[model samples]
Target: MSVNESNPRQLKLLAAVRERGAATVEELAQLLDVTLQTVRRDVQRLAEAGLLARFHGGVRVPGSTTENIAHGQREALNAEGKSRIARAVAGEVPNGCSLILNVGTTAEAIARALLRHSGLRVITNNLNVAGILAANAQCEVIVAGGTVRSRDRAVVGETAVDFMRQFRVDIAVVGCSGIEADGTVRDFDLREVKVAQAILAQGREVWLAADASKFNRLAMVQLAELSRFDRLFTDAPPPAPFPDLLERAQVRCVVAGADATGDPTP
Candidate 1:
């Protein structure tokens, strides 16, 4: 096929990369039906455009890359509030249960709470969670192997979804980038939704843990219907159509301990 300039071959290549979850030059060449040299040229151009990440002989989704941050840095940002919310979520997980934790900063807090518990198996795509649990002697933590999105340290793509289906989880603890009055779950990265959906399939119950900021904004992908989740944990009461929507969807809303002041907040 001839490449189009307005929506050029590089764009097509990036879209294809997003779809196939491929991370290398070889994989891109095979998928695009081009030569290695051509793939290299396309890749170089895409890299220059900030549309793709160049790895050794491969590429990765820019926003989904896994990362490591010092505990001090994480703790400094809303530490006490996140800790309370995490503790509340941890109470929901009984001993001897399997859970799927999504890749989000808030969900990382929940995973932190889980680190103190025993006999709980957590399958996750969050590198932050995985690392925390690695030091814990109590919980069994399994990382979903796939291309790591360095930006968020979220494991994503076909391989991650494929691995998630191997076992069922008692609960899937997830964080959404945004929420709608209609009870829709949203995220900017559509590929991450594929991984989230897979995790949903494995869980008997789905709990969405979102901060107040998730309201109003719209994330690009809808991982699943809000009705699919059994519970929604948030720092404050939902606004407007949110309550009605969640009621219609039959999702129980659990508000965390108000806000930092122990009063009602978003």
Candidate 2:
């Protein structure tokens, strides 16, 4: 295989990492039906090119940056993927159910998808989500009280976390900056993480929504583990170890539709 960016093998490697979130050398080799050395070399080239991140034993889609991405940039990152994920997640949530939505572009997408649903009591830390749901008179939108971060219109602080503990909802839809290979969810801000944590805790069934770009990104705080989610909805399948890890964790991964490689729709 040509070890360049245009090489089919390299492209496949990137896609696999993005799907699975992360994959070890052995896992990548098996997935590509290539030798371990070839996988390593491809990973090395991709890492050097700034397309992926190489860790101790595997490669993952690179995280955007050490800091949080600007809200506008995040909305533009994987617009279609987030839309697909939101639709899939929305399918699982019935009308008239109580929900807690954390702050993120993907979470905002979920809110948009839920606009047609009636009798939804949405508790959210995102002003954007609140505004979208508020337009639907049938839906009761509850905004968390806290210091609003102007960058993303996210409400965070002790008050937000405390507010989240007041009600146990039917579902929790959350987004993350990154997903670790070992099933850990990540975020850049500690305050946001706290509110996310509280939201996760208050939901009976947790669903994590993220686009393929979220795989392999590094965030400063660990929000929760993949095990905490009852289901993970995304635009594509996750990498090797994640399939096994999700199985062990009993977390179902719902693919939105035909993936980039023309994989069959779910």
Candidate 3:
């Protein structure tokens, strides 16, 4: 069967791979209630189209720059945790100030949280964030000009990086795909990482917002070390060496819905 057919089985297969990160052929067959042969055929087609990857025993979703899931999928990944993190971050931002934001689902959540604040200037490379904040007439939204990635509406490349160099803001809001044990933040796209780096450099104080799942994930490009951020808002405390690293770096860590080292509550 064709991968682009939009049939129920193929769609379900895609969803399954996205949910589990990776799946064996047998797993997909059972999960989709399809024959092993049918599963293999569908996997072959999807892999050919660069939607997924083929390994010895299974097919896996592509976590690389080109094949990452749509923004909508990311928004649904950790909805509640992101919202809480957003609220905490919103509390940290004042009514009248300049802020820089970058591309990521968590950054989008922050945009929604900032809607009520007035007299704020927001510069971003995320088209989604620009749109979400544009509704606030009091908040000035500045979008970077660059190559707009069709898959996720993320603005990246050198133009985006250069665009971010013009301002030193009060705070920077950013997100990443993974947080390493060494306290490094990482993402799958090097181009996007460059833009993030530029944004970080232009901000007086940087705030990183990521869900706990990032602790267990890995990505190809390094954004920055946790030391670069003044504060980190997350759903849970990081595991292992990270806790000590953050303490040493003096980075305030805010855990959503829980009291921790950096709770923003009054």
Q: Which scores better on lDDT, 1 or 2?
A: 2
Tens digits of per-residue lDDT for model 3, 1-266:
33324343564676567657899999999987889998998888667655578999998866664334556656665566677788888888899999998998889888998999999999999999999999999999999999998777899999999999988999988999877676788888889999999999998998899877577456778899888999888866566677898899999888777432223542
Question: Can you list the residue pairs that collide in candidate 2?
Answer: 19-237, 19-238, 20-238, 20-239, 63-217
Cα RMSD to native, each candidate? 14.6, 6.8, 7.6
lDDT (tens digit, per residue) of candidate 2 on 1-266: 32222344665677777777789999999999999998888887667656578889987766764677568756755566777777777777888899999899999988998888898999999999998888899999889899999999999999999999999999988999888777788998899999999998899999888766566556778999888999888777676667888899999888887332222146
TM-score of 3: 0.74
TM-score of candidate 2 on Cα atoms, chains taken together: 0.76
Better of 1 and 2 by TM-score: 2
In terms of lDDT, model 1 sits at 0.71
**What TM-score fits each model?**
0.68, 0.76, 0.74
Total clashing residue pairs per candidate? 12, 5, 0
**Sort order, TM-score high to low:** 2, 3, 1
Q: What is the C-alpha local distance difference test score of candidate 2?
A: 0.81
